[model samples]
Target: MDYLAATAEKKYLMYISQNYSYAILRPLQQEILAHGGEVKWFLEGDEVNPDFLHQEEQRLMSLNDVKEWQPDIVYLPGNIVPNFIPGKKVKVFHGFNSGKRVNNGLDNHFKIRDCFDLYCTQGPSTTTTFTELAQKHGYFQVKETGWPTLDPYFSEVENNPYEDKQDPRKTLLICSTFSRRISLAPKLYEQIKAFSEQGKWRILMQFHPKMPSELVAQYKALQNENLTFVETDNVLPLLKAADVMLCDTSSILLMFILQRKPVVTFCNQNPDEHLVDITDADKIEQAIDYALTEPDELMAKIEHFCQQLHPYQDGLSSQRVLAASNELLLSNPALKPKPRNFIRNLKMRKKLNYWRW
Candidate 1:
């Protein structure tokens, strides 16, 4: 029954650009290790801190190193991967489409880049679109394997962070997307400071990795007895600890609401019926109060929305992802050949400085 006793049979490579991938892939890594598989990380982009790699995990430093290691599968959290890389490039996705704007006659979330062989979609919200896209592309397969990142989230023992505090208070988590055009971080500075000093709730502030340094610093200065600013590769714990979330169009909202908690959004791109969305800064205080109370009608809407977003609460999502990958390996190749985008592939090759044919 113990597969861990066997020598690692399959090798998996985690190719990521954001630090968030550490949290996302770690659950899958545990599953892979349990199944007698090896996982190596290939971190690209300046946003990913190499220091985030755990001591037990190994990082393949270069494109050539990845080739030399010869992984059976390369799991990508970002959109694009170099075609020259060996193995089946699988798109695991970093976040759900949090209603970011579509661009250039294309929807950002559903864009079919020619790089991936299989798409491990989160749920029906994404699977339906990707399935149709796969039918159109004829070169990639789509599998509705719930995201691997939420495995830890669904399995972990819930905690109340204020358990030991002399004065117990509600926990509020503030997360903002990095996009200046869509982010509420800058506008929320004054409001957050007022909330911190008000001491009605325990506040946690986490910003996107690419959020402006000055804004991050400004929020950092607001740390006090009631407010705590944390920087971690995993945001799940914060999501678990908070009673309610205060966010703007960040996918973190979708992730939090999946926990069946209320969210107060600030002018989200597509403010659906689920959120306590407010357009005016003055209404934030009122919204937070409503969210914290967890109104029955609002709760019903959130529950319905969560089912549409991510219905898997069993925490075996990682296993499903692995199973999907295995199915791909055992199945026949796509009916049609994968199309090559010279410009995108060229950019990737140049970015990695890999020219070997």
Candidate 2:
């Protein structure tokens, strides 16, 4: 019986985000290293300006070094898949999100689908979408393992007591991803004003990864005594501190759902513009109003949804993710070979043509 520990002596490369995806990748890397494999990390930094080209070239050189070492496998965490590499000699596995309806109707999604050797999704719906894409692309091997991050929440462990303190006054967590495409600032500001006017609950605003520091400062300047803002690398601890989470179409809501905490998703932006299905917009709004007006009812609904959607909310997700990876590695021992190096092959052809001339 050749176990993962014995086989993982081979080298592996992991492509990950320097800030956002570290929480997910760090644990997986640790597991691989525990099994005797050597792991190298290739970090993708925020490319917010013209200097992005230089940063990308430097990163490419790092990747080239990894290629030269010829690792047996490459694992890419969500939204950071490396599709530009020419060789398929190393098996590439992509981890993806499934909470939102419309993800990757853009260029990044297409690149991920076309380039990765294997796809792994967090939600059932996402698995279906990936399966369809795989069939369309004539690549038929994709796996659906529920969101690895949520595995901890679903595990068998004592619920954090601090998470369930039901005071007559509740805390509302305003969560949103900072994207120009859908600036949640306007809607969140409006909700804060309205929610505060009621004076029934405290509000905590947590900014997204891409949010500007000035925006957070400006938000703090308003200084509604009941309002607080959290800016940190870890939002899960904050999520546990919250009673309710309000936001628009980001995967954080799914995390809240795992907690069995009340959630209200805002659909202030044009729904059709994004690929997300917004047919339940009115219901989402109603849920928000219900949470504000009748906390007990909203909490009950959240509990029901959690019972149906997630029966597990412990902190063992990292372990489950490792188990899933081990299962995958056991099922497939042969590494996928990369096609001929595109650039080298092209240069060789050019040299041969010159000699003929």
Candidate 3:
């Protein structure tokens, strides 16, 4: 008996970046491979340059890759959809989008949902929100797979290499990025400086991968013995060490939630069109201060928020997502699931109201 026949051979493609996005997609891809499927990875923006494209073409042709590695299924991990190739024999295509809110116009949502053969979501709220929006716009069939990223946390061993030796001074994890769309640097810097001056805590700032060297240098210049910044390919280890997490709208906060760690979302910028309303800045700052000053209160709030945000914050979330994917694959073997009309319509309403355009 052929295992591939029993499990179904799938050619999975994932675009990787050095961030939480990769963390969310990697496990599912691994699961597919473990089940006797073929997986291929394409780095984000990997073949943008003409030189690189030419090299890629030569490599493909030299290896007779297109014919040799005929992909039955293609999986795109994030929202960015690839252009369909003519004459390509892809049997199914799966796309995953994990944003808390939808920023692009309703048409954009429709475009993305319609482009992929199957669509999977991160959380129940996101699923419901997008589903309604798609339905409003006359789309149906978006699958609520929960969040695959949170899966690892469910079963993750609490093996903190730094746990036994954690500095009693209290360690805070600060995650931020440099974005021209919103200037959070000054506000974050001010908060960090203020917290450091108290001499009761130490900060470990994790810069976004796209942040420039000069920007990091400027941050490093302000560093004292109590404040430190490190550039790393991964932040999971740091998240494990942190007593609390400070971040903007980045999805890393979702990871903190999964870990049941205290989190303070920096709401200095206006809410994006696609996401939930802005968390109040004053409230945000107060929350951070509360977490820093009152450990018990922060933990309580963390537990409550985890219950509200994700039903399953433990690491088993990946299994849920995988099961959803398998269901879609089995139910509609010919065409993958796409977002329904309800989500598109709801988003259209939001766009018309100027709530999210």
Candidate 4:
């Protein structure tokens, strides 16, 4: 028997569409390699940086490569898994499912589509929701291994907790979801301008990768002596650098929450009492003050929220996810994940335009 075929180790294929998700999936790749499994990578869009591939350039596979290899498992960080893809389709999810009202909230983030064979949920809330959805929909398996994106926070223990820069100025980070309905950037620009003009704090703005470039340009124009706009694939380091965060329903808030820092969200429909919520644009400054001054009062609630979302601070979620992927690969029925729902996924494909099929 061929060594690749005879060995118990499985082959894993990962589809990373956005650079931001790269860090989230890296740990899983490391774990699979450690377990004697072969790992292949594929970039979803033109945004891929060839330099990032480094020595692993040979491991980068195309859609045709995916068809030829037919790995035992497929991991996707986003919702759409494409039609007729080989292997067990697992949804590792891009971020927390905070139930923001985008497209009436009917997307697969809340509803189950047939393309995913398994859902590796981020926390208790999401796991419970998807577990009920799995039972109700009757098509998939739900596992509550905390999101691998967050594994870095737990596993790579920090020697020093976040500390303010030596400069006396407090730092503020602004992040938002992409939906026009819920995105705070559009609504809060004028206020942001006023806040930045104050010159009291250092401000950094990072947008969702999917946020429109025109809108990003508009925000970039606001940059001044105190405010800076950042466009990057990774937000983790910035999250560590900020003293407070302002966001509206982006799962990125969970990352900041894990650091036990206070966040202020604007126009958030599904509000968590633990977050400082502001409906009035004029109240943005007050919210910032509260986050900077009263974070201690919210520390208990923030910790409670973190525990409920993910109880494990052990940093082994990637190993758990890979282990679960292997178990499913061994026992999952021959049933392939169904094609994307034409009406829903088609519109999304036209909107995002990444999948070749």
The most accurate candidate by lDDT is: 1
TM-score of every model versus the real structure = 0.95, 0.66, 0.68, 0.85
Superior candidate under TM-score, 2 versus 4? 4
Minimum summed lDDT over a 10-residue window in model 4 is located at 1-10
Model 2: residues with Cα > 4 Å off, grouped in runs? 1-3, 6-8, 46-61, 83-112, 152-168, 190-199, 212-214, 223-225, 268-289, 292-357
Q: What is the alpha-carbon lDDT of model 1 when measured against the actual structure?
A: 0.86
Candidate 3 or 1, higher lDDT = 1
RMSD of 2: 8.0
| Steric collisions counted per model | 0, 16, 31, 0
Estimate the overall C-alpha local distance difference test score of candidate 2: 0.52
Model 4 alpha-carbon miss at residue 325, Å: 0.7
The 10-residue segment of model 2 with minimum total lDDT is 48-57
Candidate 4 lDDT (Cα, whole model)?
A: 0.77
How should the candidates be ordered by TM-score, best one leading?
1, 4, 3, 2
Candidate 3 lDDT over 1-357, as tens digits, reads 332343346554543322444555666665665677665544444322223222222222311343356544444544533332111121111212224335554333234445344456655645676677556544334665555655655555467543436467777777765663443454556556766666666777876666667767877776776777776544566777777777765555656655766666666342332222235544554666566664665567656655545666555544554555555455555433443456564553453332321
- State each model's CA lDDT, in order: 0.86, 0.52, 0.52, 0.77
Q: Which lDDT tens digits does candidate 2 get at residues 1-357?
A: 444554366655656553545455555555666677776655544422223222212232354565576655566654334434322222222323323434455423334333355665554535566677766665425655444444434444355423435555577777776664555565456546656666666667777766776767767765575666766544566677776777765656656656655566566332221122223533543555465564565557656654444344554444444444555455663434433355654554453332221
Q: What order do candidates take by lDDT, descending?
A: 1, 4, 2, 3
